[model samples]
Target: MNFQNRKQLIVQTVDERGSVDVRELAELLQTSEMTVRRDLVQLAASGLLYRTRGGAMKVSLATDQFRFANKTAVNADRKDYICQLAAQDVQEGDILFMDCGSTVFRLCPFIRNKRITVITNSLPVVAELMSSDVTVNLVGGEVDKERQAVHGLMAEEHIARYRANRAFIGVDGISLQHGLSANSEKEASTATAMARQTEKVYLLCDSSKLETDKYLYFAPLSLFDVLITDTEAKPDVVAAYRKAGIRLIN
Candidate 1:
């Protein structure tokens, strides 16, 4: 199998069986033990799995809280501040498309009382808005266990069926060169679908993501109606974005 396909299968195997023995993986993949070892090392380095003596294991919450908690803990206050800034633009009776971004999730508490309809793929977003005044439409798809979100073809199709006034999205990285990007195709596709179906798009990104680029570029800076960030953002960086015609609300 190709590296990408092998990688996905490796991750799925760990998710399904809770762990993967090197010999078993090699047999299942029809590759060598060395290939399995190399794959395990790469996955472990990427925080996708825990490397064991002769195999690898799933990255459960207890082990590391996976990427979701680890990412949330990083610049938690900054993320909240960015979200608060984004919340200022929200209006009553608006329909919003929220993505499965930790920063986007923070906007939930601030917008709880607004009579808004939220169309989202985030499990956390749906959970937070469950008892609120906001009406939620969760897209149908496979649950991404680690990210606590729904993704895949069905989710994209569901998102395409609805239109929104505003889409509050997140990015793994952003840059003038590569635009707004995500670490995985599933995330990129979902965000792209939301942006395509929304009238205006708001990017909720922290200062740290400025000028950085990730694996998949889904949208350009021009796609956003406004970029909301925390006050910690550098003046020059904000100026650069504004100069490039990206409206900023920091």
Candidate 2:
């Protein structure tokens, strides 16, 4: 393929997969590994893909980051069910904490007029619940445009003041070994603090995240009171969490 055609293909691959493995790229492009590396460098320089250790990642608000919109599309239906199950645990007048994430966003639709107090860092969640009787407080701080979540030291301070009866949170990956993880350290810190402030922590995760590791670690699965997932979840992974004394729900 010509240089222009090859570059387009590389960009397209990363766009579709969110990331591209270098070895796979070389094989697909029928080129040497060195040539693929050169192409990736050019793409990175041109504000296209961001080159990582063994691959290239798509560009987003945070460079090489995934946005909430993209995430909401992944395993959407399963996330909805998990969110539905989470909402059943709420009681009237309960002070709840919801983190900014696609899975948690699903809970907003199910939370009707419960006369509950909700403190959250997610913009979408606040917007969804605006008309409901639920008293929603937006945690103020610098907004993370990509995740559509408010996070930073200022937000963290506000979250520390109130203890929550329950905290519903999500993570980029849920590993039995590594605990919770997110793409950004700031996001992870906000989530970790929210979990600590709550009497009970419920994690909403799709099957895809089970046993997967990410760049930043939030907390171990043992720290969570329960995990709500979908039926597609791997049995072994669920068993691992169950063995750790964590309640797993589908």
Candidate 3:
């Protein structure tokens, strides 16, 4: 596997088991202990994990908190479905604002062949689209190692200078009370900036996120033009979103 894919697996393993020994990871990855240690170092630097003497441990954050790689592994099938649905709206020449959320990252492969411009803060998104035909403009700012995205005032300022036809974002929580929220203020700010600069905003998430609330509330239900989710979403919750004038695609 490529380094990024391998790093993702390492993050998943650590997340699942809570902690992982370097030797064990090396065995599981079929690579050298040195390489495993190197991976752990990079992941730790990004705030994804805590490196120990001989292994790594998952960071203890709030309940809704998760590293980007770990987030990618959760609800894999649902996220893939949502991403596929969201990709249907992409036009060849569209300029897009892709958020740093894991769900948004899934949209990368589906839209790779289309000739489009993507402005994003997600590191994985940039890596995923680097070799594809899509034009990628990476926003610069403070890097959130755990989220594998850029954030902070500089990033938001850079995003403001450009506009997009569509914006695909991910949220930690979505509820009638809070509207939309994220685990950190930085992420919320970045998403908000993207939403403001786009003509249409698509919130890509799984059904579980509905009715949930997280650390930072960013936008209201009215900010999103559409929500793409898996079919397992609760009927009442789905209805509520539609009633609020946000399009729902299950």
Winning candidate number (TM-score)? 2
* Ordering by lDDT: 3, 1, 2
Per-residue lDDT of candidate 3, residues 143-232 (tens digit)? 988778999999999999999999999997788877898767887888899999999999998876777666677788888888899998
Q: Model 2: runs farther than 4 Å from truth?
A: 1-64
Q: Which candidate number would show the highest lDDT if scored against the true structure?
A: 3
Local error of candidate 2 at residue 132 (angstroms): 1.2
State in Å the error of residue 7, model 2: 19
142-169: candidate 2 lDDT, tens digit per residue: 9988678899999999999989999998
For all predictions, the C-alpha RMSD in Å is: 11.0, 5.3, 11.4
Displacement of residue 91 (Cα, Å) in model 2 is: 1.1
Task: List the candidate numbers ranked by TM-score, top first.
Answer: 2, 3, 1
Location of the lowest summed lDDT over 10 successive residues in candidate 2: 58-67
Query: Tens-digit lDDT track for model 1 on 1-250?
Result: 9989999999998776454568768868999999999999999999999886567767773285335755565567888888887888889999999999888988899999999999999998899999999999999999999888999999999999999999999887788888888768988899889999999999898876777666677777777788888897778888988888888888
